[model samples]
Target: MKFTVSAAYYLLALLVCGVQADKEPLKDQSRLINLQSSRHHDVRLHCAHYPDWRIADEGDVLHFHSPHYPRLYPHSSRCGWQFKGKNEGIYFTINCQVFEMEAASGGKCKDYLSIKDESQQSQMFCGSQSPSLTVGNKVTMKFQSSYRKQAIGFTCTATAYLS
Candidate 1:
């Protein structure tokens, strides 16, 4: 098959990045997908609704942060997001760039972010520490704040891939 220069470049880039495409669609998005890191562009997220879901494509870099980032988040606020591969068999990973919330007290966090997957793995995060974690193609993130104290929320990016 004759390939154009751009086509060849695109394919080569995919290979170098370790992303692939197959004829079969992903049966279970939660278990069949794997995540790798890549940066293409930035997409800022607006947590206007209680829960929202977004589709991620290969090379997509989506950003999510608290309302009025770089400032104190509102008390008693809640937000959530769910990300899935736009195309079949695609995967993604999240890297937290900024994380600052009310620190945990007595092993409990008044304000925190929770990450969960279909595999039943759930993790809560708070304070200034940022976490980079791997999740299935389908994952959910929820941020909650109490009426005690507030701090600068979090900024995270989700990069999509395929394998």
Candidate 2:
């Protein structure tokens, strides 16, 4: 009778341990699934809106290229982005890594990237290289491609800073 009781107690202990072991893996699995779901949701949201243009906030480093950049941007396409500074004292700046677009025709870039600020004027660029540009607290950049020709596109980073 003593042996029977001891055996029963040992079996109960084993059952409890098994349940705990099973629960730990389940908890870990649940956490992993939640993390993956969150990442998938973020990607879906980004893709849904403004697939071409990327928006940047203050202190954020934005790295983007012309759609399919380094390859040819689509024929007859337009892409753009906006950069907003954190405060009135902050400004937006862009540093281009790769800037290639259709060359100028008749002294004007048929396909080019345009940067506009609050000054009511637009600065256009078309070349394999670009000079860094800084603007007010908010700036808009646009890339327009012509239907006839295309270039490798441009890669650039934008940042926000004070003064």
Candidate 3:
């Protein structure tokens, strides 16, 4: 009878430890997910300060803005953004929620934003246009002013997908 009790106690201790070990990995995974979700702020800061391209994770909707957004951007300013998916199999979309720039003159934009895809397809916009576009897996965008005009700039959102 004493041996039976000892065996049961040892099994119970093992079960408890196994349960605890399972819980710990789950907790760590949850923490990692939370950190990834919080990367939006870091991405925005990086996009604002850097013009280089960066690959984003799937399902991450990243926000970017022109320098001094919602205010007059500097004259002759040049800003570029290149957003790519983590792999070539992924696709992404870009949409401008708020957009304003120098208006076109003589059928040409003095200050404009250009969006280009990996296929060499490109589009340019100016004035108060807000555009929504999708590219295969990578896209490049640039905002340029012709040293003569500045406006409220633009605010854009990009979301990546694995499709």
TM-score of every model? 0.71, 0.64, 0.70
- Summed over model 1, clashes come to 0
The TM-score measured for candidate 3 stands at 0.70
State the lDDT of candidate 3 residue by residue for 1-163, as single tens digits: 4545546656664564432122222335444432123333225723333567778877777788887888888887777888788898878788888898887899898888888988988889998877787887878888788888778888888888777
Ranking by TM-score: 1, 3, 2
- Candidate 2 has an lDDT of 0.65
lDDT of 2 by residue, 48-97 (tens): 12434334444666665787866888888876776566466767677888
**Highest lDDT: which candidate?**
1
In order, the Cα lDDT scores of the candidates are: 0.79, 0.65, 0.74
Instruction: Give candidate 3 misplaced runs (Cα > 4 Å).
Output: 1-42, 45-50
lDDT per residue for candidate 1 within 24-94, as digits (tens), equals 44467675556456545457777755667787878888888987788889989988888787766777788
